[model samples]
Target: MKSPVRVMLIIILIILVVAGGTVATAMYLKHHRHQAATAATATHQLSAKEAAALQVSLPQMTTNLQTSGLIQFTVTLQADKKATKNELTLMQSQIEDSINQIMRQYTPDQLRNDKGLNSLKQTILKSVNHMLPTGSVTNIYFSQVLVQ
Candidate 1:
């Protein structure tokens, strides 16, 4: 009787430990995932009206790549606010120069793939945001990307 009682208590203890660990792990994951999702959405999720109001579209650009080949693209920049959009328009020449400089750093082959294109966009976003004084750029969109 005594042995049986001890065995039962030990089994219960083990079960409780396992259950507690599982619950803790699940809660940890849930909390972290929620935070991550919120952060990602904060940066990317925007209403259509907000996006349209804050967007600045650059004229088509034609430039030579680093190694060889010509590239042409039209970029639309999404600013954080109307003021930022206005600033972007005012600084269009500087932005174009920045884009041209960045474009010259990549080859046609680099811009051909999705990974490369995404990398380019990220680089441009970071560069543009860094240069902004009043407000930042939220996102970048390439309306047209043609690499030859």
Candidate 2:
């Protein structure tokens, strides 16, 4: 009788341990999935904001880098929606010219890196905003990039 009781208690203990471990594993996975979903939602929200901004594709331009190579890329400018089509059209040449001027300042190696690409975007955004009085450019998008 004593041996039977001890065996039953041991079996119960093992079952409890397994159940606890299963619950913990499930909770951990649920928490991890929630965090991943939150991150994805945040990214989607940012893209939605960008979509709201007015987008204008600049003409493709080619410029020689300071050192040895040439860089060619198509740039798209995201401006404030308040800007009129006529206004943007009128300043199109100036915007393109400003972008070209800033592009000339970067070396081929610089444009190839993430940091350099960010810098170029900032430079173009600031320069384009300075040229426009009604609508300010919010972001710069590169449709295509080629460094040769």
Candidate 3:
């Protein structure tokens, strides 16, 4: 025969178990409600806006050489995207000025050399990027290079 005290202890244990189960269920429901709200908010969030800007264009460079003064020679160059076209265009004048300065510094022989042209291309692009906070000249194109 169980003592009265033991019976009371058993009843208390069952009650505690029931209480724990109730608390766990409440906590679970609360967490799920928060998760659902978060999911709904995420679904309503807007996506990022695409950049509708133009890619930077590299200006073509050609040089007239006094050393090879017989005629003018051409060296075509280009750059990859460092910034948008508008950004590049905004700094176009400054970039152009850099190119002219570079050309003026080089002689006919150095201008004719392919290595020299590449070097000039990098320098011009770097200078353009410096002038425009938002854009860079990525390529140097010589669409109509007349080395006469």
Candidate 4:
């Protein structure tokens, strides 16, 4: 049989232990939540200048290379927000024609090299920007390219 004072002391210690565990869990959750929120803010923060830019994905293109092969690829155009959707739609055909003409100039070997690919992108960007009467293209990205 335990003494009454000893039983009371044991119960008080258990309560203190349980309260400490609860406090620790709450603090841990709070710290992790703060970290997660900070990470999300960091990743999604956008500057005023960056918000003004726009991106448009061009239609996938398949054309014959200068050599005995076919080239299939998709391109994304980055431009200013001033370029309206109507302007882009109106120039789609002309853009496709310009890209196809450029594609015909590159052989499979040229398409495979990094330097050659950069040259091809520059050429296509220049040609497309030249054809656009409304807006200018700032950059060209080959989203997917396959030369076979």
Instruction: Rank the candidate models, highest TM-score first.
Output: 1, 2, 4, 3
How well is each residue in 55-123 modelled by candidate 1, as lDDT tens digits?
999999999999979999999999988889989999999999999999999998899999999999999
Give TM per candidate: 0.71, 0.62, 0.44, 0.62
Candidate number with greatest lDDT: 1
Write model 3 residue lDDT over 57-81, tens digit each, in one string: 3455455454454223332223223
Clashes within 3 Å, all models in order: 0, 0, 14, 0
Q: What is the lDDT of residue 113 in candidate 1?
A: 98
Error of 2 at 84 (Å): 5.2
Per-residue C-alpha lDDT of model 2 across residues 67-93, encoded as one tens digit per residue: 788888998876556454346667898
Better of 2 and 3 by TM-score: 2
In TM-score terms, candidate 3 sits at 0.44
Tens-digit lDDT track for model 4 on 53-144? 56667889999999899999998776655554346667778788889999999899999989999999999888877777776776788989
**Model 3: lDDT to the true structure:** 0.57
Show model 3 residue runs off by greater than 4 Å: 1-83, 146-148
Q: Candidate 1, residue 33: CA error in Å?
A: 16
Instruction: Report, for every candidate in turn, its global Cα lDDT versus the true structure.
Output: 0.93, 0.80, 0.57, 0.83
Question: What ranges in model 1 sit over 4 Å off?
Answer: 1-44
Cα error of candidate 4 at position 76, Å? 0.8
